[model samples]
Target: MPKTNWKRNLYILMVCQFFVMAAMTMIIPFLPLYLQELGVTDPQSVSRWAGIIFGANFLTAFLFSPLWGKLADRHGRKLMLLRSGFGMAIVITLTGFATGPWSLLFLRLLNGSISGFIPAAITLISMTTPKERTGYALGMLQAGAVAGGICGPLFGGVLADLIGFRMVFYVTGLTILITAVAVLFFVKEDQQKKEEIVKTNTIEDFKKIVSTSPILSLFIVFFIVQCALIGINPLLSLYVQDLTTSQNVAFFAGLAMSVMGFANMSASPFLGKLSDKRGTQFVLLISLLFAAIITLPQAFVETYWQLLIFRFLLGLCLGGLLPSINSLIRHLAPEGMESRTFGYSNSFMYLGTMLGPIAGGWLTSVAGIRSLFIASSILLLINVLIVKYNVVPAMSKRNTSTSSKKKSVANL
Candidate 1:
């Protein structure tokens, strides 16, 4: 918990977070294929079950994120991380051994129930880092996660094809176990013990956050932003197929996805530093505006390359979105309530993650693939206005009040 160890902890958490995201994402691309191997051989059933299998974790995760977060606040963030990391390592490994879809779904639910590694890491880093440097630290952490997400699908698909779908699960589990071990041995968590936190009603705590300036609004902003971003993913492969006559649509689809992650990872650290210097609100507002503008053109793209370019630009804008949202959450979190605040934010986020695809599918069935992009643009634009009215003025008012206190002390 010494000052110097914060830096060490941040670095270690970044690496562990990368492995955690990669390991989890590694199994995503093979769910439906794995279903066939498990005897759900009918194409229609596979598609239905694939969507169910993909969403099962998030549904459980949405329900449990807040509970784990509350525990993080009362116990220790490190304890939560170990509980999740080790628990997931076991659950995920067992997932590989599942003989049927029912077992797979049950194990995924278990995985989601125990998961809190990223949030725990975020809370720990936020508590440890200097306020002024928090944006930079969280940004770097996000970059590591984005990098893992980008690599995970590619490696998972290849490994599934080469070794088998089952073995990939074991690899994912082993990687997560190693990540847990790294955190156990190296990461340092500085937090109040259980007795130190005032025993307050969880509902009262939630009400307090809602009444506070910008915290609740920021939570909504993050959920909407995440929704707008993820809404495109379910349709992306189909969009790529429509644009290309070549059979290498998969390659182009991968490129489109990878390039966006590349742009996001490349821009995150720089944007985080910029937000620290200028302001997170300012950076976030502009990012939302540009993200909306960039998304609009995706609907009009005539070729894969044009869509690729827009997606990359959209990624650059999004790079500024998530980390800044997270940094602001850390700044605005009340004393002894930081982890709980993040917990609620994570709940809203998991909700968005679950709903985004469903919304996209529904919209696409009604209108078209092109309409989903436009709708995503509209959501971002709506968030831009929310931040403008709901988030921005509150932050300005707080800053003015802080400056007034400083001036009064100077006069004294």
Candidate 2:
């Protein structure tokens, strides 16, 4: 095989990730409002529909992501990216033309079913990059997505205010379409022949991968971390409302939400580089520990500003997590099965994403909103132990034995 231009690929994919994330988020700020415009006048109904529409995509994405991963392995990662990117563009554009809540909900479901561009991109980058550079490259890729997510809501709000909600969807669709074109033109993949590729049963393949302790631990950690991160989201605004004296509760809540994103965006690249220099497990463990610690304080904040500050700190800790986890997965994955592994990992992630809000809402109803933070903290603490005992010790033992063999070879 000829040498791959991984640097070029990474840069291009970063841009694609940014736009894709931006497109996804651009609809968020206006989703409920758009539903209202489409004839859902009852406030309670609007709220119910908003939750349903929002979650519809993730639910389907959770079910379908592994299938996409299997296909990516069989054909190519680039093809999957193109499929998702174009698929999203068309669905989002169709969403702009939706006349009722059902149509919009259906479109969101379709969108979720097709979702995998970012995961595919990650798999491609993981496959192409040199092992030593994986953490930094994945971190950079994560930063692009984070940056887009940070900017998207703000831009969506401004655009919604200026041009109205429907127009925002049109603009978002166009932006995604542009990203797909960029990928089509700029990104390249190393194609493998059918005869060279080994076929495997998807169910059996998933079982084989997760049976490994370190990788299984990482998958569980992915679920727990996502649950911890997003579990607080549904109630965050309500929590802010309780903590604040200001009349503009919406603005303050939005600010609180955005500050975390800003912090994550700023810290991701630096932490990624740090993981590269130090080690993925080192970064993952420290970040998980600190994230758990920071999360505990948010449950007790008396003022909105205090909660905001803690959320920011939590984001800083979170910056190290996904990139390090991804780097570690790449390190641990068997050759030629990288995409399938990532696909399964993403399924766990989407499952967490779907479950997080439900768990948060349930916890709030049963135990109150503050308990959500505490529960998240406990989950993350469990993850810290998982990494410490299962991931770290296993990695160290493997490294030590590998080193001993190297020394033996040198002496011989």
Candidate 3:
């Protein structure tokens, strides 16, 4: 394929990526509301149920992320994508049939256990894209995620109002099914067999990765970011209702989510590209600090629009953290191990997801909504300090290794 053609392929693959992500988020944004409708009324029960519903999917995803990556390495990325799409379709479709909170939670568990499309898509793009262009390409992929996140909640909320939450699941499932079919037919894979392929023993590989310096440290930051991001999610619908007192809360709630999405969408690429020039660690520290500063203002916001603006600002700061983490993993890991490393990365993210909402629920109950921003801000600031002095230096050492390898090749 011509060079230009390969770039076009990247774009095509990303569009598919956006669709799959939208399907994933469609169910997620409406989950807390759906649980309310399912008869979980007490504040504590609602909070716990919200965490259970969201965390269940992520717990499964975390458990399976590395395993899926190994499978992708063995069977081919396109095959992995197909698996992810089909799995999401089945599990998400089942969500619509859930009669109670427990049933919905069960489906979320199933959903996590089965799904892996985002990681699969990342793996595919990593394999196909040229080395020099990787940051740019991955940034584009991240943009698609931001777009999906931005649009999914807005579309999901509106659709839930129009068609009801159960029917929303049906639509999401069908869209994912289409993604599977699209990948099966349209997404081509490079058939060249890779050497040094290790069968995925997730626990063992997880240990190996932990032993690697900076990777573990990087994962800590990922965990923190995931916790901070999701800590607000279970409360967003409720908070919007409190702030706006609107009867049609879904539209405003969706807009609130879309604001963050739009900010992330706009900022991620620039941050990714900036990482290429200024170094990922530098970008990470700045983003973390920026996010921390912006988040504090959220605690004082009285209006929904003010909250929306602050959340958007927060998103801009957070937009680069994940991509920078990915760039660092790519920088540190051996070529064939990319899939596994990314898988473990997702697992850490899931751990955060599992913990964040649970913590958020308790905190919000005790301290109220204002505490969400305060807690997140404090954690982010701490993260920023850690990244600036600790993670960045370790990563710089790793990049030195990468630079030395490049110079050695140049000499040869």
Candidate 4:
């Protein structure tokens, strides 16, 4: 295979990530309303169907992610990206034509089965970029996704109000399709390296990857952090309604959600650069510590504005976590296994995504929405302890051993 320019590819992937993320999230702010429009009249039935349909995608995505990752390892990452990006574009567009809840649910399940574009993009960038620059590249890619996530809801709400939800789906589908086209023309993969497959069995491949201490610990941290990050999502709007007297509850709730994305978008690249200089382990520790501190206040907020502020601050801390984790994974993964390693990691992430909202909703029913925030904060704090004791020590010893070996080689 010919040499490829990774920096150029990174820029292209970032643009694609932005569009793909935006397309995925565009329906979130209005999904329930869409269900109501589709003939689900009873409030209880609407809620139940909404939960099932909304979660169907993640549940299937969690199941299928590792398979896709293994395929990317054997084939190439860009092909997986093309498969997911175009598949999602078509599935989401088909969703616009769903006449009832079941049709929508089925489409969502299909969407999840074909999904993993972002993870594919991450794995591609990790493989292409130099180790020293991995943090920055992944960080910039994250910023793109977060920026899209911030804009997606606002755009969706406006488009839903102006052009209608069905039209919004069409527009989102077009946007994603355009991204797929760009990847087809602009992104190039080194096919020569990916042709060889070391592990044919997916289950054994997953086990082999996770059996290592560093990799296993990173997966645990990723799962817990994602759970904490998304745990409050199901109850965030209700919590806003409780804290505010304003009639525009939806707008405030949306703002509260977007503000965190905004902060995360702004902080990701900076934190990525910091990780490059200071070490990913150091950056991960600080992010988790600050994220826990910031998250605690949201549990006690008396007003919506207070909650938004704390959430934004929490986003700043979140900005560092995923990039640090990805960078570490890139550093630790064995040669030619990067995609499969990330595939398992993405599976853990999807599992957390699938569980967090369900767990949050249950927690809200049992205690209150406030309890969700408290639980998330506690989970993050516990993750900090786990990382400090297990992850940091192992990473430090590895770095020391590597440095000593390099010094001995130089003397010889």
Candidate 5:
């Protein structure tokens, strides 16, 4: 790789992430309505089927992400990117033609199986970019993703009104197809094949990840954070309704959801740079601590504005968490196993996405919506202690061991 080519690759990949993420989420706001169009007339059945369709992607992604990662390691990250990008582009475009809910459900599952472009992009950049620049690059990459997430719904909503939901899927498919083509034409990935390791597979990769304490800790942190954050999503609108008397409840709910994403996008690049300077462990600990502290206030908010403020601050802290985790993983990964490690991390993320809402929905029914926020805060705090006691000390020992080895090498 050229000295400056990594920068170009990062920029292209960031743009690609934004469009792909936007397209992936474009259907979300209108999904229930779309389901109704598919002949699901009963209210209860629509609700049940909507949950199933929404979760199907995450479920399949959780199972397949590691497989893609292992293949990425063996073949090349670019191949996996092309594979997922083109695969999803076609599958999602065809989603516009689903004759019924079951067919749409099948497409969603297929999309999840082919969903690894973002993770592949992460692995590619981690391999190509300088270590000093990794945090900033990954942070910017995260920004692209969040920015897409924030914009996608609004875009989808307006487009749905104008062109209809089916057309929106068509446009989304086009967007992905164009982005995938851009990646093929412009992105520079000089993926050198690693020396073959005998008896390598996704199962063995899982075992290796479990045995690696630091990597395992990062994965746990990601899972816990995702579960805590996403678990609130199902209840957010109801919580907003309890706090506000506005007629346009949907607007306020959308505000609550997008504000966190906006703050997250703004904070990610800055936090990434800070992690590069302050050390990732320190940034991770402080971010987790503040995130926990900030989360508690939401459970007690009396007004909608207060909730937004708390959510913004929480997003700032969350902006630090994932990039730092990725940075740590990039450094700790074995010589030829970067994609496999990141792939497993992606699995945990999807797992959280699938499980978080279930847990949150159950908790809300049993203990009320406010209790979910409190529980989220408690979960975050537990993560804080785990980071402080387990992850940070593990890093210290690794650093000490490396230094001692270097000293011995010098003495020789």
Candidate 6:
């Protein structure tokens, strides 16, 4: 196959990500409704099942993320993308055929295990882009994913009303399959020179990186951001339920979610470019503080419009977090190991996504809506503190050393 320009390849990756993310997120607004169709009518049971269904794929993804990352590093990111695309296509198509709650739950698990295309795509973009442009590239990728999150549910709800949920899955699946074929045919990886496989065990390797103050700090900050962002996720449906008793609950819930998506979709690229200019750590600090303040009012919202406004603001705050994170990882990771470092980052992110719902569900069950805002706020605060204490100090040291080196070279 002929090679494409990196920008063109990035565009392809972005389009592919849109399809993959849309397929995943579109299911969210429909799951409870779909379960109702399957005869599970107990409100409490539905809530529990909803949490399970939401988390099942995340947990599975958390488990397999590193392995996919490692594979991407060794083989090629393009192949890994193919694996994710085809795997998701098959499993998501099967999800449409699920007969009951248990079957659907199983499909979600399978779906999570199979879906790591975004990480693989991110890895590819990170590899392909110049270091100076990494933030912008990652930001664009995040925007595409968020855009899918915004539009997918709205479209999914409408499609479900028009063509049924099962057919919606089929359509989403076929769309992704087409994307997979595009990747296989059109996208190309600039293959790296072969190197001997490092003999270090995974645990020891992880310990070494974690021992690095810079990389570890990035991990902690990333975890915190994911926690804060995901904290409200599982509760969105319940929040809508609290606001209004309308039978068209799913449609409005989707609209609420899409609003956030649109905000994030609009803001991520700009934040990413800002980070590219100002540095990732500075951007991260602002991202955490911004989200914390904006997201708190979500807990107090009494009307659907108020909730929509806060959710949009929350999305805008979150828009920068992931791009800043990926940019940091790109900066700190050693040359030629971008995929491995990013894989480790993905593991932590998946961990956060998995824990967020569980924590959100538990707090909502026990302490109520206030817990969502308060807990996420606390988490974001911790993240900001970690960045201030751990990350900035180390980055300062790195910058000082680089400056000294440049001066020494000039004097020579």
Off by over 4 Å in 4: 1-4, 194-196
Candidate 2's C-alpha runs over 4 A off are 1-4, 193-198, 408-412
Q: For candidate 3, what is the lDDT?
A: 0.80
All-Cα superposition RMSD per candidate: 1.3, 1.7, 2.8, 1.5, 1.3, 2.4
User: In lDDT terms, which candidate is top?
Assistant: 5
**lDDT string, candidate 2, 45-88, tens digits:** 99999999988999999989888988887888889989998898
TM-score of each model, paired residue for residue: 0.97, 0.96, 0.89, 0.97, 0.97, 0.92
True-structure RMSD for candidate 4: 1.5
Off by over 4 Å in 5: 407-412
Clash list (residue pairs), candidate 3? none
Clashing pairs in 6: none
Best-to-worst order by TM-score is 1, 5, 4, 2, 6, 3
* lDDT (C-alpha, whole model) for all candidates: 0.88, 0.88, 0.80, 0.89, 0.90, 0.82
Q: lDDT by residue for model 3 over 256-361, one digit each (tens)?
A: 7778878888888888788888887898888888988998988888898899888888778766777777777766665566677878888888889889988997
Lowest summed lDDT across 10 adjacent residues in model 3 is found at 1-10
Stretch of 10 with least lDDT, candidate 1: 190-199
CA lDDT, candidate 4, residue 240 = 93
Over all chains combined, what TM-score does candidate 5 have? 0.97
How do the residues 114-186 of candidate 6 rate in per-residue lDDT, one tens digit apiece? 7888888888887788777788888899988887777777778789999998899999899889999999998
